[model samples]
Target: MRFVRLAADYPVTVFGLTFEKLLIIGVIAVFLLGPERLPHYAAMLGKFVRSVRDFANGAKDRMREEMGPEFDDVDWQKLDPRQYDPRRIIRDALSDADPFAEPATPVVARAAVNENSAYLQRKRKREALGAGDAAPFDSEAT
Candidate 1:
């Protein structure tokens, strides 16, 4: 037996950068910045990262506060933008139809009306008369 991994099972990489690649980038940055400016830039980068982290955490906390208990009930995976598909959305909406509710169009009346239509009447007559015979071709139609 073989195990198939889903898309969600794979670990996501930022710009496909590994630790070795990031170390190489850091070395290049250090050479470019030099020892003097490197410390200042590193401190600034740390501060920027901390601020961004705080901002994200604050937003999450704010959302939790606003939503109250419903925040935990939200299906985060379903809301992911990557999984979004208009066809899937429409299919789900259609599948969630109320079984007990009345249909938008009356099936019996629609069928009766369709049987009375001139086109249907002609088709039925044609089918009944034709049986296994080939359909009559009109050259004028072409």
Candidate 2:
């Protein structure tokens, strides 16, 4: 039952090798391959890993370019799993308010109407007075 539980819950790790085991294998490889040959092999391995990484990066860049505007417009930083969910936050805020409720009868427009009327009256009076009449006269009587 215990083994079954381990197999069911953690199937992958159950058969995985540890770091110590990998170290032992590397030591054995060095012995078999010899110290001098090991450096050359290690260099070749490093080059192989670098080439594979470069190829992968190039492919990714090419794919992104080919996808054109669709992929290009995506904001990778916003899409990151670690970022907060904006939709959920907005939904929670909206749910707290009753949408069907009539918005407090919009503040009576009487105040604005009065202000508008006063403005119009002043504008009309200024227009009727004409620009010359609106000008100030000097007491010196030039």
Instruction: Choose the strongest candidate by lDDT.
Output: 1
Per-residue lDDT of 58-99 in model 2, one digit per residue for the tens? Answer: 998998889987887888766645445566467657776675
- Candidate 2 stretches with Cα past 4 Å from truth are 1-21, 72-142
Relative to the unseen true structure, what is the C-alpha lDDT of residue 2 in candidate 1, on a scale of 0 to 100? 24
Q: Per-residue CA lDDT of candidate 1, range 61-86, in tens?
A: 99999999999999987666765566
Q: Tell me, what's the RMSD of every candidate?
A: 10.5, 22.3
Range of the 10 consecutive residues with the lowest summed lDDT in candidate 1:
103-112
Candidate 2 vs. true structure, TM-score: 0.36
Which candidate ranks first by TM-score, i.e. highest? Answer: 1
Instruction: List pairs with backbone clashes in candidate 2.
Output: none
Off by over 4 Å in 1: 1-25, 90-142
Full-model lDDT for every candidate: 0.78, 0.70
